[model samples]
Target: MIRLVCSIVAIVLCVWKVFNWAWWKPRRLERYFRKQGIRGPPYRLIHGNVAENGAASLEAKAKPMNGFTHSIVPRVLPFLHQTVQKYGNLSIFWVGGNPRVDIMNPDLVRDVLLNKFGYFTKMKPNPVVKLFVTGLVSYNGGKWSKHRKIINPAFHHEKLKLMMPAFYTSCGELISRWNKLALEGSFELDIAPELQSLTEDVISRTLFGRNYQVGRQIFELQTEQQDLLFQSSQFAYIPGQETTATLLLWTIVLLSMHQEWQEHAREEVLRAFEKNQPDFDGLSHLKLMSMILYEVLRLYPPFPLLTRFTSKKAKLGEITFPQGVQVGLPILLIHHDRDLWGEDVGEFNPTRFSGGISKATKNKVSYFPFGWGPQICIGLQFALIEVKIALTMILQRFYFKLSPTYVHAPHAVLTLQPQHGAPIVFCKR
Candidate 1:
């Protein structure tokens, strides 16, 4: 009996090894990259580059990062930016033994996102992520189209205009609280949770037409999901599929960091209102809110990375990708890539988007904060207005700065977030 058990164990180990070598080798797609004359660090077996990527992420999170030098994309994918630096525009990397080709050329991106989106769909997702976030952000093909159509009206200009009052109310409450704090002398508040509460309030009131109680629950659940996902350390998950996890990572991180921006935005809202005395309906008509929406989406996109999968044989630009290969859009990487956005690519310059997104990049496929093509974010306009109304009202009264206890460590746990907490000081203006 002991010998029988030992034999079974031996057989299982051998079979697993064979499968890893023959089917799941990280370099299975090496030939595809080689055909395109792209070079990359040699792929590691089974683990590929994921272990090193994880280590590098830990290192980045251990210290404060200079905005220009702090690379959120490379931290998530590791060795990818270095590969691009060495291999030029097109390159390949692995995500846990899965081959994902990274294409930075705007023309190639345009071809894939615009001309041939049907050929690529969302990456094969983890079963766990498919549970929580089952919204349009994760859908593809016909299902994607249907969801997009249904969600479109939520973001219509008229609908957004109606939602403007909710934004003002939430922001007003925050400012009023700060006013009381200022009167009491030293009031140290953590801005991370505060802004989160603010955004939650907006999403709740506008999305569900109630207070932020439900949105707050969703946000708290998402925080738990973030922790669970990190323990799993798996990517290529479905949208809103992670149950308690979230898909909007980058926006959270940036809002946590730019405390001063919050203050400036509040001032802008007040100034606009004072100059025009726009009521809720009138405030919705304010152009400054529109500009702020564009700027924030550009600077701090919620989902920084977009992943797609190829089924059957498909041609993307000069390279032909055989079925079963995953492609990463690296939206944030493209947004900040110096080649696409001049030397100030890494700089937080909202002026670049002053003329609107289409004009921002000359119709290039680089600046898709809510994604593009048929697979574009269904809630793009909804998310933006939710943010806009929230910011406008908050800015009406308070000044923000980095909290004294704030630690500058941003990490990706589903979405980018402050590893410690978003410690921000709110001053009543």
Candidate 2:
């Protein structure tokens, strides 16, 4: 029996290697690009460019680096820079044996996102992705359309009014905790964890309409699943990975790093909530909360990478890609691009969203925090309102700051999140 098991294991390993070497080598795609006069680094065996790209990513996270050395190009995939730098702005690269063409020009991006969308489709939803945000963020075509229709009413201005009280309840909890801490003389505490807990609680009560304890438990479990998924970094894994925990971890990391923005956002939230008690009917109409939602989506989209697949041949400028390619649209890179948003793009400026999304994108097809086209995020409205309501209430009652132990390193297990758990201290203002 043992011998049979060994034989099966050996056979599986052999078959896996054979498939990777024969069919999945990056060279298979590289040669095609070379034939078409496009240039990229010669593909190495089965690992392809992953090693170099991983190394670059590790280096970038270790210290501050400029875009030229550690950026969307090289850190995302090895030869990413080489491909674009050598072949000009239009180039192709591979990730784990799949071909992906990067179209940096805004015009081509617009065409793919809007004009020629029929040819390209949202990336096949990773099975893991389906678990957490099972609502609309991962759906496509008919199902996505149906869910969107069902969910539309939830995000409407009037519906948000129905959610404000839930937000206030969650926020009040955070405030009470902070006030107790402040009474003990705590100040300059990390706010990320507190905010995350507050948001989770708010989402629980508002969406599930369940008792706060039940909702909080559900959120806590989901958060644990998120964290498990992140630590495993298994692109394909069981659906049970702790998603909620991981999301909370990343949220804390991101919010803590930008301390100044934390203060600014805190001030805004306080102003909004102090004027009202977060009453369900009245506070939903608050414009400041809406602006906060837009800003948070911009600075830290939940899914940093927007992936899609091609159903047929697609053309972006002079380059044409065959079907079955996985296209990754990195929101982090696009959102921070200097050309897209001017030199101040890296800075967190909520004012940019003052004129609303249309004016913010300058009528471009960019800045899709939820996504784009017919398959935009379904839970987007739900998520945004939850964040706004919770933040507004917390700010009215407490102050938060990054803990001294905080570190800045954002990566992807499934969504864009911090490599380390966000550790924050909280105090009442």
Instruction: State each candidate's clash count.
Output: 14, 19
**lDDT tens per residue, model 2, 1-429:** 999999999999999888866566566677766777665555555555567667766775566435212133233332454555576655565565666666656666666767345777766656665554444444457765665666667667778777767766776777677677677766555444555555556655665675446954654455554753232222111111223333334333445555665666666556655646655544456564465456555656656556667788877677677778766565655665668788766565667887888888888766876667655543455555555555565556555556776555555555555555455666556
lDDT of 2: 0.58
Query: Which whole-number lDDT from 0 to 100 does residue 142 have in model 1?
Result: 73
| Deviation from native of the Cα of residue 78 in model 2, angstroms | 8.5
**Which of the numbered candidates is closest to the native, going by highest TM-score?**
1
**lDDT per residue as tens, model 1, 1-429:** 999999999999999887876455545467656867866666776676677667776765665655423445555444566677787777777666677778888777877777464787776457886654555555667765665666667677777678777766776776677778789544666555666566566656765466677644544455554653321211112232221112222333344356555445556666667533245454555554465455545544556666778876788767888888777777667876777778876555556776877888988888776668765655555555455554554455445555557665555566555577665555555
The local distance difference test score of each candidate is: 0.60, 0.58
Candidate 1 segments whose C-alpha is farther than 4 A from its true place: 1-28, 66-78, 115-117, 164-173, 214-268, 275-296
